[model samples]
Target: MSTTETNSGTAPAQSASALASKNPATGDVISVHAIQSPEEVRAAVERARSAARSWNALGFDGRKQHLLRWVSYLLDHADELSELIHAENGKPVDDAYLELVLAVEHIAWAAKHAKKVLSPKKVAPGLLMANFSAVIEQHPLGVIGVIGPWNYPVYTPMGSIAYALAAGNSVVFKPSEYTTAVGNYLADSFRLANPELREHILTTVNGYGETGAALVTSGVNKIAFTGSTPTGKRIMAAAAESLTPVLLECGGKDAAIVAADADVKAAADAIAFGAMANSGQTCVGVERVYVDKRVSDEFITEIKKIIRDLKPGDAEGASYGPMTMPSQIDIVRSHIEDALEHGGRAVVGGADSVKERYIEPVVIVDADETCSAVVEETFGPTLTIRTVDSADEAIELANASRFGLASTVFSKNHGMEIARRLRAGATSVNSVLGFAAIPALPFGGVGESGIGRIHGEWGLKEFTRPHAIANQRFAIPGMALLSFKRTKMTTSLVKQTMKLLHGRYK
Candidate 1:
């Protein structure tokens, strides 16, 4: 699972002009990947465009077999792929394995449901056009360019890649520079699975942000981008140059609400895992928790017990690994400091918890709502607990952020009621981040969190456009409705029908 092995299997070895992928935990150079120039990105998009027609012609069944084969290939090599994820992303081995499992499930789901979701279906022509037979179908948007994030690199990106391919479009992926090796490994595996179509199918363009910018404007039919909000906006703007539609999955300041009747222990465990897993680098990771005032003390006690002994390091038994991005450490530190300065009390770790690369879990209580720690996305293993007078207040506070990504509600009753009230893309009742594990659920957010969705049927449609067709069944005798020779009798009949349908409804 060495970097050279990963890169060589898919394509030729990286040339001298390449970027180094370093391990965030140890600061070791894990692999060298060729930095694709803008020209190279455009070339990859062109290749995908050329291959899309034949791939789509294979139809749903043909594509399903190839995608299922990819699933099997990925499952067979899960351990190896997980190792690459660990080496590059600094996540614990088990976490990386879980990510791979979810990614495989998404691919399988997309393949199995593509036809059912995207196939043409008859539609009623309405009374005004009863003589016409109408239908609608989803057609591939040609080539799709995906800009993936580093955290959960495999799972997050595949949400776009798998569905885009399932819907009959060729993909040109630009993985995060930090996880270039992992991306190359996936592309290589896909090529191996479909060797005959390798030249026209999935392609990987390894590089930094500039490479991603190039991909956005690479003349692809559409772009699916997952990253920070600012970056998502930039990608959208770049794609606008080509009028290429973009689906953005951006950052989230997700919140978890605990009702008075919730099971304290279960809620504590779920929140702890949701907040600290992957060192809190998840896009929908739990960053805030609003609890009922009646049970705030009990909830805090239970959560503290769950995380008190947890450690953050690269050790075998550590709860999580180091921060994937070095710059993120400063962000985490600043958030913790701001909370403490704004009338917040640290229940677990605080300013001293942030190390060179690893950040011990930090839990702050009673932080001011306006503080940066509570208002912005920290993307670290930090949680801010704020007590609310009632469930309504909790919902209000949760919906206060500009981000409306994902949320969780823990309650013995009224879970669904509260979940529906939260203005987020998805909500998990009685659990944290459970929506992500369900392949059928759509994932994305509203407002500043970004637009569009990935996963299930929504994901299939995101990479396609609707094409409607209508056929005239039989023309009425002497109708001439569409001709200059339209008869007065036909006009009178049509007017009378419209009046009968609408004039007396009330």
Candidate 2:
């Protein structure tokens, strides 16, 4: 995500190894981070491997204490951290705090629920193995390498990091190069919170793409990345050499569907906020809307009215701040231009609304489904509204994209029905982004949007490996099917049982 903006402040990285963190709104240099070399990344991984022993030994309750302490520290320093996030990520301070709140809540959930979700569980032994007792135990997967995004820097990466750590694994975090300072602050805060814990329980490695590549191949137990689909493919390929597993939360061209029966005003407000919040950098941010033709007129008018007056700036009461990644400004401009060139009309702000640093909310109506602005992930404060004859047509158009991430539906009568029919990992009914705020729901995508879930009982299990134990409680005389001394009678009995259990279907 930090990669969204060039280290050279909207340009490419320089020959110097140090990374300069700048304000996207003002181009002010906040700080410079020393890029870690491949060797350094390996060393960090080794340290995590060593620290994993102690981390695992802590058990659920022991680890929970430290994680909660870290949460307390974050809360105590919320203002400070939010300010840093505002400066580097260009989000409003309140929005930054909201991101932190969600992240902290997820960490707390992972900590308190890890034991319940991951503890050993008894299982019934089959009739053929009646003498054996079966139990499934979940164990920490040693070390986790997390590649975070800058869009929702705190909330996104913490989804993986907190769950991984609470599940009993040590972590090596590579924050987006843009949010390097915030990442280091997090790792440092953990150490400060639990003074007794040694280094490597949680660590950070700073750099651009090279550092992340080094981490993928540095023999971590698994790599959890949140970024573009192409980068995810490359990481998967590189991790294949050693066969390390990966959990990728890639791009999303999320959509919102407004049915005819929906409350037009409510739908408009939620979708408008979802589309432009935090400058629309959210992976699950709404980029397109499919409305029923019967209500499309009112829905369009309402959304346009809501966002027409919205302006972008770093000043107080601003709708949203400037684009955090300078490179993204051009993409937003291009999407607006492409849409306009392809029979789309901008009802609110047009191509000129995209400034050097800030992008005002732009609403382009009647964009062709095949256009880039409609199909691709613009990652900006823009939305495309399309009118469909019916909810079925709306669903068809909404699911047309290769991405199947998060989507929203606003229909008092058919909200649940439309949500269930969506081709997304999570669908919010009646409100936009409802799934993201709930800690119990696991979040991820089916196709290019991403692979694997990360926010619930499933999230806690993502960083663990299951170990099944089968112990013999007693042995049946003359029924030693698994022993070398098994008789012909035992074999015949198994065949008869199989036939009785499975051959009657015909």
Model 1 lDDT per residue over 389-420, tens place: 99999999999999999999999989999999
Task: List the global CA lDDT of all models.
Answer: 0.88, 0.89
**Candidate 1, residue 453: CA error in Å?**
0.8
TM-score of each: 0.96, 0.97
Model 1: lowest-lDDT 10 consecutive positions: 1-10
Looking at model 1, the pairs that clash are none
Look at candidate 1 and tell me the lDDT of residue 462.
94
Q: Candidate 1 lDDT (Cα, whole model)? A: 0.88
lDDT of 2 by residue, 1-506 (tens): 22221211243364457888888888888988888888989999999999999999999999999999999999999999999999989999999999999999999999999999999999999989999999999999999999987788789999999999999999999988778888888899899999999888999998887788888989999999998887887888898899999998888899999999999999999999999999988889899999998999999989988998788899878888988777778888888999999999999989989888898889999987788899889999999999999999999988888999999999999999899999999999999888888998999998997789899999999999999999999989989987899999999999999999899999
Model 1 steric clash total:
0
lDDT of 2 at 470: 98
Superposed Cα RMSD, model 1: 4.4
Q: Give the true-structure RMSD of model 2.
A: 2.0
